[model samples]
Target chain A: MKDIIIRGATIRRELFFFLLSFIIAFGMNLYAIITFKTLWAELLTQLPFLILVTLVIYLIILLARIVFLGINKLLRIKKNKSSV
Target chain B: MNSPYKSRRAFIKKTIIGSTVLMSYPWLEALANESAISMSAANKVRVGIIGTGSRGQGLLYNLLAIETSHNIEIAAICDNYEPNYQKAIELTHGKAKAFYDYRELLDIKDIDAIVIATPLHQHAHIAIDAMNADKQVFCEKSMARTLADTKRMANTHYETGKILQIGHQRLFDKKYLDAIDYVRSGKIGNVTQIRAYWHRNNDWRRPVPEGKPELERKINWRLYKEYSCGLMTELASHQIQVANWVKDAQAVSVIGVGGINYWKDGREVYDNVALIYSYADGTQFIYDSMTSNRFYGLEEQILGDKGTFELEQNKMYSENPPQPAGILQLVNNIEKNIFEKIPIGGATWIPETALEYKGEYITGDFDVNETGISLEVFVDSVRRGKPTPGLFEQGYHASVWTLLGQQAMETQQKIYLPEELKI
Candidate 1:
């Protein structure tokens, strides 16, 4: 049951990051369309570009998450040594 | 044996030339005439300009631009105002004979045609005199200040048998011509309504040269009732002409309301106006002009049953727009080896409102100088010794209807076009 809870939480965290990345990609595309005075309907035609941008953002987030976890682990080790 | 490459090349060249000729306006047909191309002193059309104000100078610039290509000459120029007269003489590099009075300029028998760019009230008089003097007249738009003068001008054109081309430049614009063609070809499926507006945020006033209070009326004649019909004739006339041309019918009646809601600087004309002109076929041309807000700068929104044309923007929106090929759609087609609709956006993703479809351009090449084209065509007509068919009637009706709209606003009643006014 504990393993199941951890797996579910992991999935939720991944889903959150993916959704954030997608929203950012959508916003950037929307801004570009508006700036160019193009139709809002262009968003549908730019599906591939949107998906590519979202994946690129997600990869960057994932890399940042790993770096943040590593930094947190190092900080915790330093705190324990100081407490000792 | 016949060379296939040569035949193919010949065929392509012929097709291009044929399509260009087909797309061109009827008056522009003169450009292809052999007589028009042969440039000589005898064939050159000598043009006299009666007004050297802003509009007159604009026409002069266009004429100068096309002088060499069209075999035209600025024979003489006349203006009562000192500044404009001096400026016009400088524009022609002292080539055109300058005159203080228009009659003296008209007296020059060698001047084949005269362009009238004077104030609204002066159009009929100058045009009539020029035509009577045996010179073809190319007068600026909104034919005249009064309906009687407008009618008289048309009558003079008819009686003299001289070319009287009005400055409705849209008739010569390729975008307008293409859009109108679409309307006529049932591409738009019967235009139901047309909404046109011209808006600006300026006070519509010109400077009076500091202490020269007397020159206000002379310089800014458009603001006064005696010299102009204000926005109706100055701005609305062009759009009304477009609406009439699109419907191929004049406004049978008009009901309007106007007031000096803003810019209350003792100007006789209204600062804002809203008018609805009804056609015989139940079509309505909704028109308005204002000098207070300019959010919607200007456009002729021609709405039909199947489509809509925003002429100023050069776009046409269809009721049933074609779906463009997206990446997912292309991938789906390749995977399935067949084309089929795929529901990409699910129920939650679907938009609540109607889809905002971006319409296609009316034509790719739309950066045309319509004023130049109109003047070139007018010069051609003068050379041909004939007026362009239907051009005079279009200008006449636009002016008459514009005056009728003014009357409606003044009386606060639906004004119908009188039988006698329907030339």
Candidate 2:
């Protein structure tokens, strides 16, 4: 087996993808919180709660990435088998 | 060993003080473990109710009936109308907080779910808002006033991935389930047609107070086009839902004829309607509703080549006559004098009597009410964080076709449901 390493360009592309994902996840949750009229003065004062929300969203995005990559690999294998 | 009820009660008491206290109560812990009672006080699903009219109140009663079994509490109730709001509050024993506006009720954080029993037009807005609030929704049937609103509600359900249960109680009805099974199992032999009708003689109106003539339309919303589609949404929706369920498909097209033949006193909606919806498989559902006559009140007949079943009557009639019972056979033989030596028994000696076919009972004693069972299912789904499958689509199809039928009636032409609206 050959040693594998990710290139700088590949790492940059991955970072861009993660940044976009984070924006989408956080924006959606924030929009939901505002829509439900849950952004009270008391709740807004709590920094830990906001941080926890952000962390949960990050975890969700990470899980989604794993699931999507797994599905992509499965699809590629299926395509190869069909070609064979 | 203590009874399940006793154990559950004791567990509730111990868990209420604290989990530490519950751990110390070894008997309660053992009872809870033995009974598999996993729910604690925090796990109880809090429900907010919108619209406390007759239908909404009935649903509240059903919810209350199943509260103990399902671990649900009516946290809040909302109705703009003062009388209804007060009545609903009283019904809840003043346990639930009452709100004049639904939005105020929706603002509460502890409410895990919302039951929307508002008029037809308000369903989409409230349901979409509830889902946006990250609350599971159980909206009453005739999902929305327009095809566009119906589509939006359905799409929102998909986008949110929250449990959206529409108020189609027939879906949870054991009798209807058994009937569907019988129809699908070839007992009815390919249901070719369904005839459904709801008839009443009285004016479909709630009496308004003498001082408040301006509130006439508001009080009797069913008679107005702005708030409701009259009998189509109020009555025919139930039968149409059953038809769609039995066929296992929605109508492709519809044609209808309706008019204000009776009760035309400032009413916007037609008093009589006759519509036919054609399914993809060529099965037709013939529907009619009238306020002029109350005779033959309401029923749905599922007709096939071999047999026909009247769902409301709970009776099944077969095309081929059934064999007579042993006593009846003996009686027939005695009447015909077949056992005795027949003096001049001819080939066509004259039929003794015309064969009569009285149908047999198909439904048994169902102790559980349909609405109660449906509420139980809805609460269970909300608690489990998953909707009862296929319920949303059933409601959507029924509502779409109902509106399509209304459109056909209004346009005076055949109406085909647009492809986009099919889902």
Candidate 3:
């Protein structure tokens, strides 16, 4: 199972993955909106906070990815230095 | 595979990360424990609030907000603090008489229930007295500042026929309630351990009073251990209660380390503390409170085998990807979307072209509220005499959170629940 692993995935495929997730999420959101009357009201009322949360979550994911990549690079450099 | 120093650094980072993830579990943890079963009823149960301070005010606010908080009315208000007493009177539109002594407040004619939101030391005495006085009571968290007091309080609660609810309100929050369902439903798998934390900046900001020596300390009693349990009662108890709610079990034993590193203003309670509680099921609930930082506001986490739910900053959410993105998925999305509109309808009807992917973030507010939901339910239970999600045991459970921490601090050794202690 460990040998069966694959870490590298390309950008388009990532987009495809994102789209798939978003679809599932949106569908669930729609379902929630239908079932819960308050969701509709909240979307209308607390729209600003809603937008802010979305922006923040987006930034977080981006920042997290950058930091993760940076850390990975730092580890690689440290490894090379130790080898030398 | 790794260098010695590198491994050491990695180990330290991993340890920190692991602890962090553990601490993150209870934020959306134990959905307010749902035991909304019926209790035998009595009509016209009048309720009074002692220590009409912040908590008293907050409860009043909740009571007013709740749609159907039944026949019970605030018969009286008591507070050593004149401002709080006056405020409650104003909130009640002066409908309720203000009393300086809680004894007077508790003795209000025909009063059947009392809300004791006074300082920690007063909790055991006031609650036991009120119960003995034949009134149902809701005392604030960290039931008592002392183990002796807790033993007495618990005993009194059991001995008395009157209902006693402790002011551990998270048992009422909807997010916690929903999360508990997930936990019980085994969504996050079998919950073995839970963690909680409360981090805040500023020096407990209890105002340094001018000239009024005795009264201010008596009223703003949380700053001193003689009258209060310090942060153990004031802050840690809140998170500890949350851990209890998450575990759905009373703490069996606890060990903790506490240090008053931040606030140096003649306070006895540890300014920073960490406590670990064990349950009968071999589960552990851990808590930490540090006043020097608000890097993390407030949250608790319940951990299970499959995944962990992160309830933090009042939003109960979960994140786990044992495999962040499977190989096929990673290729299908990562490769194709960046390359072309290449409909990868190979072998499987993968809707690659159909949906556009979001890389930055596709986000929405998960309406997982923590505080308000429970407050509403508590009020509804009182008003309609309907089954309440958070009832008497929640109070006891919360008290146990405080007591466990207190004992750990006192003995410098782990404290265990009494043999009789049970949910």
The native-contact fractions of the candidates, in order shown, are 0.04, 0.00, 0.00
For model 3, residues B282-367, the per-residue Cα lDDT tens digits are 99887888889998877787777865665543333333442222222333454578887655556655555622322111113324
- CA lDDT of each candidate? 0.86, 0.78, 0.63
- Model 2, C-alpha of A28: deviation from truth (Å): 85
Question: Once model 3 is optimally superposed onto the true structure by TM-score, how far is the C-alpha of residue B10 displaced, in angstroms?
Answer: 50
How far out, in Å, is residue B409 in model 2? 0.6
Shift in Å, residue B200, candidate 2 = 0.9
Tens digits of per-residue lDDT for model 3, A16-73: 6455545444443444455543345543444444344445445556687789999999
Calculate DockQ per candidate and list them. 0.06, 0.00, 0.02
Candidate 1 docking category? incorrect
How many backbone overlaps does candidate 1 show? Answer: 0
Arranged by TM-score with the best first, the candidates are: 1, 2, 3
Q: Order of candidates by DockQ, top first?
A: 1, 3, 2
Judged by whole-model lDDT over C-alpha atoms, candidate 2 comes out at 0.78
**lDDT tens digits, residue span B1-423, model 1:** 233322332332333245553234445444334252458788889999999999999999988887877788999999999999999999999999999999999999999999999999999999999999999999999899999999899889999999999999987666787787788788888898999999999999989898889999999999999999899999999999999989888888999999999898989999999999999999999999999999999999999999999999999999888754343343344557655556777675746795578898987766667787678768878988999777888899999999999999999999998988877
- Maximum-TM-score candidate: 1
TM per model? 0.78, 0.72, 0.63
How do the residues B1-423 of candidate 2 rate in per-residue lDDT, one tens digit apiece? 333334334434333234443333232233234333346797798999999999999999888866766677999999988888999999999999899988888899889999999878899999999999889999998788888999999999999988787888766444565566678677878799999999999997798889999888778888889988898988888898999888877888899999898786989998999999999999999999999999899999999998888888777888786754332343355457856665675675666773477887765743336666566556666766866556678888888888888999999999997989966
Query: Which of 1 and 3 is the better model by lDDT?
Result: 1
